[model samples]
Target chain A: MARLEETTADGRTLMRQTPASAEAQTANATLARKMRRRGEESRFWWLVPTIYIIFLMLPIYWLVNMSFKTNQEILGAFSLWPRNPTIANYMVIFTDPSWYKGYINSIIYVVMNTVISVTVALPAAYAFSRYRFLGDKHLFFWLLTNRMAPPAVFALPFFQLYSAFGLIDTHIAVALAHCLFNVPLAVWILEGFMSGVPKEIDETAYIDGYSFPRFFLRIFMPLIASGIGVACFFCFMFSWVELLIARTLTTTAAKPIAAIMTRTVSASGLDWGVLAAAGVLTILPGALVIWFVRNYIAKGFALGRV
Target chain B: MERTWNNKAWFMVLPVLLLVAFSAIIPLMTVVNYSVQDTFGNNDFFWAGSEWFDEILHSDRFWEAMGRNLVFSAIILIIEIPLGIFIALNMPKKGWGVPVCLVLMALPLLIPWNVVGTIWQVFGRVDIGLLGYSLRALGFNYNYVNDPFDAWITVIVMDVWHWTSLVVLLCYAGLVSIPDAYYQAAKIDGASRWAIFRYIQLPKMNRVLLIAVLLRFMDSFMIYTEPFVVTGGGPGNTTTFLSIDLVKLAIGEFNLGEAAAMSIVYFLIIMLLSWVFYTVMTAYDAEQ
Candidate 1:
């Protein structure tokens, strides 16, 4: 029987060795202390990531500072922070239809894309992880190739296809369009996570007389909850930030925030403060998503092997 | 873990297949159709056959853009991968710092591509932007608009700032998954710092690093909006990457057939290179 226990360096079985020898116990304690000391020695290296993060945040900080100031103030002076900080830029975005509607349109499509990608991916990922079929490797590779295809290559064709189907300027159009890339990604990541689960779990569930859907939803899903979260986060992130296809597929009704921002450079010139505020608002949803999925984000990055 | 042979698995994958086919295949076929036919107006297309392909093949402009793309991807990979790894290695293994670092690092990745371009475009402006203003104040002649060298550096630096966090996040994920037991084993064996990284961390990080390299390569190769917003491929055609050039030709000039041919060629190059990288990396991964 394979007991659920982690073995030590010695040949003795960890679960059975309840009364371990004093020598072995002492050795284990000292080994742990050594590891702790090593961790302490490396603790000061935290400064490296700190400095690097400061470098990363400086440009963003400048943007936030600029957003709070008037356009004249932004162009006239180079202050570190806004001397006369104002929320008028944000007010302009909140009051404007073209601006705020961009957020609504972006959210609708991104959510739809996330749900669709993750739902379709779960079954396919389970299939890839637990079973083999005809042309499985080819199918998997082909799906990934879609991920590699540049959005620019598809821009014209996508415009034509969506317009032909009369999907132009609709949320579902961009939502379905993003599936080209997101579905493959969701499948790949979820497959990695699923492969980490033992096949015996599925077999055990089946032997218990549970149907596949019940087993998957009630048992397998909760097990790989982080994986699902990671997949959804990625799908959301990709769909949310993508502008080329969204720009191509939408004219007015579903123009994304990113596309709307581009129109800020009008005949009058760029609206620096308002544009910065919109940029800041655009970052908000992703930031919120990242915060919610922070743990899974790291686990997801590890491809859920851990 | 051996997967069982089950033809019935097709049922599980059907939805994905249908969805992807609708989004991918139809459009790809259309691109193919356009590639072989020359369209003028009124939906009139002449049988151009391979003439457009031959023209694109012979065009010096296409070759130049391809060359620029290759150099840009190479430079980005060389810089971001190592820097990302180094940052990940030094990151706090545990504590409040982890979430703070991860979130802050991820801020750039979440920003839309065009906004990222705008941030740098404004940030690098001598009149209002902090970076350009500070540099000029320090008596340096820095301008991304007129100077090709400055444009290249700004673009490279902007990309590094934007995407290194991705590599860093991936590497950090790999780093954390490594059991403390491995570090303990290395410590007990009196391993040096370099040996610990060489035999343990580096090998552990190989999978995520493979992903980082491939993603960064493909994305950087397809880069358009950022440079387009900042330089407008400016000061001349110094930064007009293949995608931007294709867009200009197809949309701006309306040479649909020639642009479609160029797109196909561009797609083929990416596909072939990605296949090579994937096979080589995954093969090496399996070996270890």
Candidate 2:
């Protein structure tokens, strides 16, 4: 299923030669390319993934198409595209305080959670990667056990705890609450990336009269920039996408857009167009983040485990 | 890489330890506390002493829900794993197609879980949805809201649409990292296509596939929002997995003690299964 591209035909025949040394590595590459190029599998195989992608996009496309149509057009017929496209649904979200505030509220807590998770996770991850502290293995595994804990189990407890602290209906409450799941994940991923960096760098930095904090900030932090980006992206994605805990923890003031969406089924009826617009809008922030980190999606997100 | 034995590293980890404790540990303790005590409204409580646990274990409802959760997770893993590997294997190795595929494939994943549920809900409506309308036009009685079989199919397909990208991404990462020399040596040996995949690709993909399977298993086991939004655990409780049942018990019916007992047992089941998976896979990896 892998695609191989040949830049030139010059090395095609040399690919048949038996490998002997460093040059053999290039010959090996050439042979691999030839195997791929000479395979009888038709290019029609590409259609499998293309068709799969199209299938994946169809529902999302429907969501986007519905967002552009009036509610009448949506319920009136199953049109593949909007007969008359209008941005009225989007206009509703932009103009209404309740609608737009959901976005702001979601962003505020998501960014807060991402920052808090990554920040606390950074030092913890470094410690795990660089040292075998007391109960390190057990502590590491216990952190992961939190990741496996269903939010359903914590939904009521979290509400009670946060309310006791008078943090109910607040963004920080949701942010801090999300740290339960995100912090463990951040630590795990970051530790994987940090372990890939040799210990010699830390020793050398210390020898140069750099204090631990300064050396960690100047040398280690930059070294794992991609890992941090990946970790932040994951933390952002989880915090942003999470609904049950966020819904339980907040009421009106800090309600997430996902929970706000439930209100679409009001006294009148379901606002399919407006709800679709909100759904499409939710995809935007994540899409923008993914675009910036697309280059790292394949590498950093693998967490160096693969 | 060797790690130094420095107990002082705990200082660096203190902040996370405190944060997770506040978030995870305390709430967990509350669940534990509630599990052993029966409470009535107005903050009145009585000692129950494992009564909730005994009742939950003996209850047919809890057992039924556990059975449903297991069946759902098993089916999801069976379908998603092979399909994810196939899709990943088929993906373009390089060029512009790579980024385009990655972005479009990941779109479903980035959408909120509830939104995914909502999308499927609307998309499966016979009156307004494309899939429902098309299926009706093709002369199949495909109503998700009212039919048990249809509801199961809709929920499973929704999960697949939502999560298959995660497996694909992980497998693709494993695929790209394979050095060209491995494939070259396979070619030099005149290995057949199946032989190449079995001997070269699958082994290289072991670690990522392990992560994919474990994540998918745990997440599928605890699934709530998407199916909850779609089916509301309806069609005569056919879709009511453990989380859905637990929520109904705790929040809807206010059976806090039994719910808490069920929660601990549910969590143990996940942890035990995950440990087994991790141990078995790592042991196999070691032998390999």
Candidate 3:
């Protein structure tokens, strides 16, 4: 009777195993097929980026092409490439004092502006990030309002104010003027980054008996180095490209490249070649600066924890 | 933790305050002075009361310019924001392609605003400009210089080309920060591609989109240099927004009082709108 019972149980187990094994195999096969399809779909994802890069590059390619060509060639009908590409346009720019002076002036003010903005912004950002004061949110919003003010609205007033103060035609004047926008932006960006840092670090530093300033300078600053870099880069770019206030504030001594570029349009007609060359030159400093800071930009936006 | 409230922290903010005051406050005071007074020449002034403000507020020209400014800014925001988001979505996220894509995307932004205008100016010339020449060769009558419609189109297109990259970069930054786990979860749930984008990507992009919209709106509203360079306010003020008109009034026409009044109104609108944007965005972020 015991032997008969064992045989019946074994037979039932086999019957159950057969269908279960078949179902398992079918599921495995289906998953493999779906994954293979996904791999194929991902391959075509390359098309999206490829088209996007091409779109981005076309205008730049056109600009560089124009920079290489002469006035006559530029005025001539569309050519795929410069027919008689010469460095004469570039030469004209490098040799011209006014053109080179614009660079020097732009660099001086941009640097000054960056320095002023970043230094001032660092503490304000830290305060906002670490401590809540009276009307902190209101103050932050008020700072942002300065950035929103139209540059055109400020043009006549800025000129009048600077002239009255005898600050017009000075590099410092333009640098100070730019702080109206840059400082707030710098503060905002830095605050975002700083807030992401864990409070425990500050506490640990205090436990080590470090004073606030020392801890902030030696400890906190390095942690937020990428944020500072990104902020400074933006400050440099904005100050460099800005024309309205720069033009309005300075007639000769501190005239920026943008202002100088405008002078190319005279009764004689646009100096297309030199203008193109200058335009190309104006782009160089920003490109160089951004290239240096490109690695930090992503990190800066990561809000420091990354 | 000693959470001592240090008023000395105020010292840290003082430099920025001073600099901003020197630049913004003094200039604003001057604007106030100009708005209430009339200047004929040689810096001589007379108290004009609310006459300039009345004139500016009543003038059809002022209202027209404001209308144009509003329309232009709206069009720019509409075009740039979505287009920017789309481009950002497609940008390469990894590998050797990343640097190349980034550099290419940044090229337009690196170019000075006036230079961008200059490039478009040359690029849209019917004779030499590739775009204009190509269009003409293809048998389309496209001349931005003489035709108001063409000029407006060219100006708008140039702005898009120049500023769209900004939105793209901001949106790309926002998009890339999204964790991969979210996508994996969506995939496991068998979500449609559209569902993934709608439920995951769009919501994630909201903060940056808010930024992109506000920035594009303010900047486009204040746009002067590019249009000024490209068309010099056009074949008869067709492209003249408020800034252009303000410049024309203040410098070109030498009506300081009217210009100042107009500028004050312009300033207020921008400030009020920007405040609204900030408040709304902050509230939204807080709720999230």
Q: What's the DockQ for every one of the candidates?
A: 0.56, 0.59, 0.37
Where does the lowest 10-residue lDDT sum fall in candidate 2 chain A? Answer: A1-10
The 10 consecutive residues of candidate 3 chain B with the worst lDDT sum are: B1-10
Q: What does candidate 1's lDDT look like per residue over B135-207, in tens digits?
A: 9999999999999999999999999999999899888877776765677688889987778889998998888
lDDT agreement with native, every candidate: 0.85, 0.86, 0.77
TM-score of chain B of each: 0.95, 0.96, 0.95
CAPRI class of candidate 1? medium
For all candidates, the clash counts are 0, 0, 0
Q: What is the TM-score of chain A alone in each candidate?
A: 0.88, 0.89, 0.82
Cα displacement (Å) at residue B53, model 3? 1.7
What's the best-to-worst order under lDDT? Answer: 2, 1, 3
TM-score of each: 0.93, 0.94, 0.89
What value of lDDT does candidate 2 attain over all alpha carbons? 0.86
Q: Kindly provide the TM-score obtained by chain B of candidate 1 when compared with the true chain B.
A: 0.95
DockQ of 1: 0.56
TM-score top scorer? 2
